[model samples]
Target: MATIDLTGTDFEQTVNDNEIVLVDFWAEWCGPCKQFAPTYSAVSEKHEDIVFAKVDTEDQQQLAAAASIRSIPTIMAFKDGHLVFNEAGALPPQALESLIEQLKELDVEKALRESGQSE
Candidate 1:
């Protein structure tokens, strides 16, 4: 499964309503994004449990701005309508895979509650 093209209109519905969503924010002119595309696609194919989406920064400026994406190849993972991970950089296949595996083990709601308590 390659990355799904997400636009401003469908972004909320796709990410919020979905169980787990991994969004890759990128642009055609970005070299690192181009370099990371293949790895992203490969991982998407392997991770059947997650919904992989891509937003073209050039095309979806509104969505990019709303997400506060200042850099290309920003990857974000969302679960249960909450952001679990937000990182800017092009990751190698192995690192991306490892990160996703770690995310799978995390209980986001519990973590959020604990953090809120600490705050």
Candidate 2:
């Protein structure tokens, strides 16, 4: 599926509603963000079952803050309504693909416990 723009209004609901959601926090002026856009888009196209969403940091400062985005290109992955992976910086196409595989195989309950967010 094509990447969608995410806002604070829908962010929580979107994450909750999808089995797996990958959010890209970025700003338009960020060179690395620009460089990473195509890779993100291409990867999103390949993963039809995954929800690929982007939040423009400049325009969504509150949402960015909520996500604790300290970098321009922060990638956050959520599975089963829980955050499973997060990293700053751009990921190469292969790394992005590998991350998808890992997310698919990850045990969400175990990950949430490890992250100290188990409910």
Candidate 3:
């Protein structure tokens, strides 16, 4: 799937509607953000089941601030309505792929139990 542009208006609903959402907070001027774009898009195409979304920090400053995005190219992954991964920086292709693989293998129920959160 192609990466969808997310704004403050649709961000919450989009994340809630999708089971697995990968949000990329980025700015066009950031070199690292540009570097990560292809890797992110490539991975998105490979993972049709996941919702790959991008927030242009320059345009969506409110959304980025709400998410506490202090750096460009911040990638956040959410699974089962919980934040599974959040990191700032451009991840290598292999690292991004590994992150997706790890997310796929996660046991949501067990994680909830471990966190002492009842479903």
Q: What are the clash counts of all predictions, listed in order?
A: 0, 0, 0
Worst 10 residues of 1 by lDDT: 110-119
Per-residue lDDT, model 2, residue 19, is 93
Question: lDDT of all the models against the reference?
Answer: 0.91, 0.95, 0.92
Give the clashing residue pairs of candidate 3, or none: none
List candidate 3 stretches off by more than 4 Å.
none
Candidate 1 per-residue lDDT over residues 1-119, each given as its tens digit: 66799999999999888778999999999999999999999999999988999999999999999999999899999977788899999999999998889878878778888889422
What is the Cα root-mean-square deviation between model 3 and the actual structure?
1.1
Q: After superposition, how far is residue 106 of candidate 3 from its true place, in Å?
A: 1.1
Write the number of the candidate with greater TM-score, choosing between 2 and 3: 3
| Model number with the top lDDT | 2
1 or 3, greater by lDDT: 3
Q: What's each prediction's TM-score?
A: 0.94, 0.94, 0.94
Error of 1 at 100 (Å): 1.1
